[model samples]
Target: MKTCLVVDDSGVVRKVARRILEDLSFSVREAADGQAALVCCEEFMPDGILLDWNMPVMEGLEFLLELRKRDGGDVPRVIFCTTNNDIEHIAKAIASGANEYIMKPFDSDILREKLEEVGLIEKVDP
Candidate 1:
């Protein structure tokens, strides 16, 4: 199964994302912040990452920059999951190497669609 890391400060957000990712057949891992997520990546690179914008320790953009610098880091499909919906934030995320972006309060379908859009998953029947 493909592996996914869900990085968020909120336990509830992490739990919800874990469930959706699990349903999509991804082996999921959770991290409370970008620093922790980076540590997790160092141990074993995941196939994809669902990252939040704001958190303690390191922020998502900083982590993305650092992650892209590592060997094999370019391979993971990164999707920024956050409440930041402004064009500037979205543009920055895309430019920083995120494969896609999803707003907060996402449901399984929205998450699944974003994954599909990024070519991380095959299309599923309704």
Candidate 2:
């Protein structure tokens, strides 16, 4: 199964995302902040990352920059999942090397679609 790291400060968001990711057949891991997510990546680099924009220590963009510099970091399909919907933020994310972006208040379908778009998951006949 493909691995995924879900980085969000909110416990509720993490829990919801975990359920959705697992349902999609990914082996999921969770981190409450970008700092922790980096540590997790050090031990096990996942195939994809669902990252939040704001956190207590280390925002998503900062982590993305750092992660991209690390060895094997470029392998993961990084998707910025955030409440920031502005064009500036979107452009910044793409410029920083994110494969895709998803706004908050997302559901399983949205998440699945983004994952598929990034080629992290394959589509099935429905």
Candidate 3:
């Protein structure tokens, strides 16, 4: 099964994302912040990442920049899952190497769609 890392400060958000990713057949892991996430990645790179924009220890944007600098970091399909819906933040995320973006309060369908759009999962008919 493919693996995914869900990075968020909120336990509730992480739990919800874990459920969605599990339903999609992904082996999911959780990190409370970007610092922890980086450590996870160093140990083993996941196939994808569901990253939140804001968090303690390190923000998503900074983490993204650092991740991209690491060898093989470019391979993981990164999806920025956050409440920031502004064009500027979206543009920054895309430019920083995120494969896709999903707003907060997402359900399984929305998560699946973003995963599919990133080519991490196959497109399925509704």
What are the models' TM-scores?
A: 0.98, 0.98, 0.98
lDDT of 2 by residue, 1-126 (tens): 999999999999999999999999999999999999999999999999999999989999999999999999999999999999999999999999999999999999999999999999898658
Overall lDDT per candidate, in order of appearance: 0.95, 0.96, 0.95
Instruction: Tell me the spans in candidate 2 whose CA falls farther than 4 Å from its real position.
Output: none
Cα displacement (angstroms), candidate 2, residue 41, comes to 0.4
What's the TM for model 1?
A: 0.98
- Residue by residue across 1-126, what tens digits does model 3's lDDT show? 999999999999999999889989999999999999999999999999999999999999999999999999998999999999999999999999999998988999889989989999999997
- Candidate 1 clashing pairs, residues 3+ apart or interchain: none
Highest lDDT against the true fold, candidate = 2
For model 1, residues 1-126, the per-residue Cα lDDT tens digits are: 999999999999999999888988899999999999999999999999999999999999999999999999999999999999999999999999999999998999899999999888998888
Q: Candidate 2's C-alpha lDDT? A: 0.96
User: In model 3, which range of ten residues has the least summed lDDT?
Assistant: 109-118
